[model samples]
Target chain A: MWRCLLLLCFATSAAAGKPDPQRQRELRSLLKNDCGACHGLTRKGGLGPPLLPEALAGKSDAELLRTIQEGRPGTAMPPWKPFVDADETLWLIEELLRKQPVSMEHGG
Target chain B: MIEINKSIDKSVPLLLLLLYLLGNVCLAELRGSGDLGVVIERERGSVLIIETSKRSILARVEKLGDLSHASVVFSRDQRYAYVFGRDGGLSKIDLLQDKLVRRVVQAGNSIGGAISQDGRFIAVANYQPGGVKIFTSDTLELVADIPAVYGDDKRSRVVGLVDAPGRQFVYSLFDAGEIWLLDMRDPSRIEIQKFSDIGRQPYDALLTPDGRYYLAGLFGESGLALLDLWHPEEGVKRILPEYGKDDEKLPVYKMPHMEGWSVTGNLAFVPAVGLHQVLVIDMLQWRLVKSIPVAGQPVFVMARPDGRQIWVNFAFPDNQQVQVIDVEDLSVSRTLQPGKGVLHMEFTPRGEEVWISVRDDNQILVYDTRSFQEMARLPAVSPSGIFFTSRAAKTGL
Candidate 1:
């Protein structure tokens, strides 16, 4: 019952939690710089594996979501949950999948 | 007979005129490659051959594959630049002709490379096949391939590959946490000396100015592994082991590159991971002396060529701000906001001026080192590494 309640709560937050345009820009920069620090600026893979759509094709959404939240322990991949909330992480992952600008007007 | 003689005389004059023009074209005023460099246009898969003396670009060579993480090593003569592209494309670019002379895809994924001490070989560190590939510097032909094989059929990613004095190449194995010295003095009789358990996850490393000590920065742990090239029997020793233990490990937005770590006298200024500070280490003792507060997590803590000042650029949000650390006082002397996405900075060969690449602004801003005045600006497409021919003479640039 608690798990279901939490899932519903998360769903509601995710539905209402589309980041503002400015926040979207910040997220984009983070994806380019912060994440790019390891995964590479073009997402071709450096110390970490590639985050490009083709690279992420084999990995499941759930797996990526968990990795971003909890972080890979042994590797250089740090837990980004402290900076990015669950809802934003999902949006960022979706942005990576789309491989397009995440601004509201351009998302379509 | 008179008509034929007239035709022959006219043809002889025309031939003489053509020869004179050809001779003039061949004997154009000679120039030098000392001030020439190649600026990487990371996003566009192209390179701009730039001249530092006049602060201008000579030519733009394109179609270098996947340059998102490109690194370059100049030929001994500095006339040619061997660019190591992210997608394993090794391109040899001629600065004088301004063309891609040769390109070879030797690996699946390569990080960076180094020119051998003798400049005869180019050794590349690979992440995919997890080994080092040595090529003949002249032809980019495959000469030797040393796999970082350890612990089962697992091959560790090679990082921190630098040529030590005398036909030697030293590098760190990322996955295996080991350092290996490759002796190619006798190319046919290859010898490898391995140092196991030298800390964890050495992301990158750099050799000292004199090429004596090679230090590898640990990402998995807080310490840096130090290896003295003079004495391999002593093995690798850990330094700055407790740096991270003091503070709660902040999220490292970007990994601090170890390539351009500044060493002025006995002091080495290194970017402390996951923090807004540059750790100053006493090279003589290989110990952390002090941590100077900065604008943000320093990316490249590079010293000026003359070793008077150290300029540091940060990571991500704070990357726009470059702080100058006075080596004498060990304090933050000044900060300059050189627009957004300040990716990399390179001081002129003699350290008179600096050229900074603002990726977001799409401009290379030249600044006078002393006055800190904007000297000139050149347009580019997402420029990253600004390498001068000066690196050709220096070891492990």
Candidate 2:
């Protein structure tokens, strides 16, 4: 019984890692409107630092995720943990790494 | 007979050429003559001149500098638009010619601006270096600069700048929590009226349609600071003092946009900060009448020109939806999913249709107000605010 429970936990964790269309759409809107309000709508930088791939090239994925989750202290960048979860932050980082504009239709 | 026929043919060719030239000129004039509007393309640092009659984008004028939180006010003739950009670049664009007249980088960082009631001067509220700069509307030349000094050389950032009656400009100092009125009747000599301790951190403000009152939203605390422009000697007073005091405050994702509050008839639909509700206030008494629950934090509560329905849009995750509330019933008439990143909405002069900017989708969606049906979509680049020329006729836009 114990062995079976451990296997189930591992399976559920793996499934959570998979992409979710609904969550992707939510994150897309958050990144575009919330983050875009400070950073440029195109991520080219406005009141906040640029999130374009080139501007974030030197930073590692973990560093980006930490910034998105924990937020930089004493900066305009707010921790999105209240709105976004750990896995969603990871997914968001992946999408940001790809440097592709979110498609409205697909997200909807 | 042959000689006469040759002369007639020559005259006919000349007549045709003149007619063709006349037709071209007429077409050009027609293009320039119409109900004009503009959409601020935030990221691209451009403005899209739109002909509202045809529901089409006429031209996209670019290179206006940093337009992150840009705002536009039109000239008296409605032929020119002065754009105030976040990076302190003020640009004047000629609507008729669809070109930039002149642009000046006046400050390090600026929020927004206002034009004088007489259309003679334009004033910008600055964040960096903390002052308000007044410029000549036609020439874009600096006429006066009023530094927001709180005490002994302590500069405070100015916000919520608006034009009032009597060729005056009113703005709030964020750091000082004070409101100042600048009387600019004489360009060289300016009279300043300062009201201190108006609120904790006044963010943005707006003047009533009649220019009777100026309301400023406070960020550091709940409620707002109200100044009866007609009676400035009474000083500023607090309204809705207990708005967020009784409840636990939610983290505000974005400040509630006070400029877009809907004022129709006796009621004003004001967005509640950090709440998914709109506080309806009786304009006559200036008291909160009711709190209407919405989908999320309301960013803009706009009333159709007819004053029958109020349209509300949200910030961030809830920005995808726009809700229309019937004035009589005080209930949501319809909810519209206008696509992702809905930023701003503007109605036609007659209030027949509303143009909404969906920034993430990069399109401006036009919807029929009565039917609540999508009519047209014009492509744009990260569009934000939509302003109509009719606003030039209003007291405080």
Candidate 3:
């Protein structure tokens, strides 16, 4: 029963999305090699929004591409007319929107 | 410009110097000066207001989504106010007209924001794909978008945002042990400083009046973390533990819910959920000096400007009243039963009264702090965050 309780705690924590070592590396790479040039990989955010999952969760693929293609009329998020092909941008947006594990561990 | 003719008097040379300085001061005073009021987000569809005082609501002009939620902020001089909308919409609300005259659709999400101390720029924290977008408060144009990576975990949110003096604005990512500060002096781009070694599940943070330290409240960590602004690389300089004792030793609430520092800049208070108490910390030493026990999962704690009392809102079991705490003695002063669903409280600048947002009851309860008496309850529609402007600084019925 004690083992079961421990397992239960672990399961809940994991479900809440504690950072996984493998996932972090993959996210960092995707952001750096792929999205970094435009959106910026590190502290320096650029023309595009950061690829953090919390920001992309509810945003739809079409909306993301629409923002890229049409460009916001009032702001500087210019239409990515010649920057990149539409399909490639769509694929990148999908990956950016994917949810990662929750990080609820009290490391302190 | 009027030219002042000063005759040279060799005998009273010192008096002439004083007159010259006085003339310059008078010329400077001729320039119009006004009080800066807190700009608040009013969830009235596409419309938001620049509230100068408690009762006065100035409609800000801006092009916004009919369904968009926007956060409004005013320049220090009360000349300009910026409105940030979710999904990259930005608008400038001109204070003089009390209307939003310029709109920038793709600026960034209007989730969290801080106005520059100089009132030249406004920084907004976009919720999705967390990033900070800086805009010129005067022109209402997109200056820069700094990619701000939040919690490694997805549930963490970039909720609380504030601009530290100088040009840097700090973004507090909830449930994440990190905060990102970006310099926005240059409108063309953004400069970033990622401080990831902060306490767990950091919520809101505020700088001391002297601007020496930035204190942040952490959830689940049971402590408040202090960061030295001069050295961002130093990480958390001090950790003040929050207090709570579970009589049953059974797990109920997860951690500390919401915390607020007093306007007096002396005490830091946290609502210890499930523990039924509010933790008080001395701001200077960063120590948990006392604990004032209270009823049921206390969700929110708010300090009046005088710093004498703290109003706490209990969440679970749906208690209708907000618990009061006396700062001097650190004891439970009185239990106030205002209305159902008393979740959040916003006080006027004078600290004369507090307006409590009762969600389910759909009303904002106005109360007198001195008598602990309920004054008048204004009907509201799903009020979550209650804010008052400098114009509406008095407790009204």
TM-score against native, each model: 0.91, 0.82, 0.61
Alpha carbon lDDT of residue B224, candidate 3? 61
Better of 1 and 3 by TM-score: 1
Candidate structures ordered by TM-score, highest first:
1, 2, 3
**Angstrom error at residue B219, model 1:** 1.0
Model 2: per-residue Cα lDDT over B42-118, one tens digit each: 77788999988889988889888767678898898989999998778999999988899999999877878888989
Error of 3 at B381 (Å): 2.6
Off by over 4 Å in 2: A1-33, A39-79, A85-108, B1-24, B31-34
DockQ per model, Cα: 0.36, 0.14, 0.02
lDDT tens digits, residues A1-108, model 2? 774464445334643785578877777867866876766545655446668788888886666766887677644466788888667777777677787544222221
- What range of 10 consecutive residues in model 3 chain B has the weakest lDDT sum? B388-397
Per-residue lDDT of candidate 1, residues B1-397 (tens digit): 9999999999998999999999998898568999988899887788999999999998999988777678899999989999998778899999999898999998888899999888999999999899999999999999888899999979999998888887888999999999999998997787999999998888889898888899998888888999999998999998988887879776776788888738889998888888888999998787888999899988899999989999999886688889999999999999999989898999899999999999889999999999999999999987898899989999878
Give the Å shift of residue B210 in candidate 3. 3.3
Weakest lDDT window of 10 consecutive positions for candidate 2 chain A: A99-108
Candidate achieving higher DockQ, 1 or 3: 1
lDDT score for residue A6 of model 1: 53
What ranges in model 1 sit over 4 Å off? A1-8, A11-15, A20-26, A53-63, A81-85, A99-108, B1-19, B26-29
Ten contiguous residues minimizing lDDT sum, candidate 1 chain B: B244-253
